[model samples]
Target: MVDYHLHEAIKEAGLDLTKEQMVVLKKLHDEDGLNQNELAYLTYRDKSSLARLLSKMEKKKFIVRKPSASDKRVNQVFVTSYGKEIFESAKPFVGKLIKRMEHAISETEKQQIISILKKVQTNLS
Candidate 1:
């Protein structure tokens, strides 16, 4: 439900990327050069799925994957100049998204929700 709303918001804002792609771009922007495995872990995506996402991003010229200098088999992901611009453009929307969510709940309720989610995660594990 939340994702659907956010997707609509992004579309209305004329952003051509999905929320998932925005997340990957955010991670890369924060940490410029991350290997594929690292990105997958950080984004909670499987390697194959991440590969598909990266392929789309690559085709859009938003990111580039280069073979690691130290490890030929490892591909490091980096945001291109175009990707940075996109990231910047998405910041205002992201900020609004954050603010909207935060404003919907009190701090205490937010903490409680976090605790409940953590317990749920522990149970699943």
Candidate 2:
């Protein structure tokens, strides 16, 4: 499975991307300061599960969740300096296959592939 291959690649590359940590960090990278609900939707993680993961990340000093002044019920999540450093370190390793993937396919084909893959995902779900 691709998941197995991906896990092995991360291990072989000696990257520090725990499954939950990687998802949350990547979600933040793409869209910073997303509240917990927004994060759960973006990352496809349930709220309670994400909460536990966020708690651990907070303890590690990788992230901070602060209550919004505009809305006391809403808490915004932010990656810390340490998280940026760690995520930056992981990016190259996680993206190691990109060069090969791009090299092996034409630009047009890449677009077509992505379009077809999206349809496949929709159909499967």
Candidate 3:
């Protein structure tokens, strides 16, 4: 539901990005030049799926995959200037969604939820 709403919000904002694509864009924005495998791990997506997403993003001019200088076989992903702009534009929508989602939850409850989610993530890892 959250993902669907976020996708709709992006669409309403006149941005052509899915929630998944936004995730990739945000990750690259935070740390550019991440290799395909690294991105796969970070995004919890399989290599094939990530490759497809990257291909689509490349076509959209949101990102570029350059052959790594040290490893020609590895393609490092970087966000384009346009991608950064879109990401920046989407920040407010994301913030709004987060705020709305947490409106009924107190800070202490939010902290506990975070702690529990972290533990669950660790267990899965």
Best by TM-score: 3
TM-score list, all predictions? 0.91, 0.81, 0.95
Candidate 3 local lDDT, 26-113, one digit each (tens): 8998899999999999999999999999999999999999999999999999999999998999999888888989998999999999
TM-score: model 1 vs. ground truth: 0.91
1 against 2, candidate with superior lDDT:
1
Q: Across residues 38-112, which tens digit of lDDT does each residue of candidate 2 receive?
A: 998887778999899899999988899999889999999999999988788777766875564477688899999
User: What lDDT would each prediction earn against the true structure?
Assistant: 0.91, 0.83, 0.94
Question: What's the true lDDT of residue 5 in model 1?
Answer: 72
Model 1 worst lDDT window (10 residues): 4-13
Predictions: Cα RMSD each: 1.4, 2.3, 1.0
Clashing pairs in 1: none
C-alpha lDDT of residue 23 in model 2: 77
Top of the candidates by lDDT: 3
How well is each residue in 50-111 modelled by candidate 1, as lDDT tens digits? 99999999999999999999999999999999999988987887778778888869889999
* TM-score-better candidate, 1 vs 3: 3
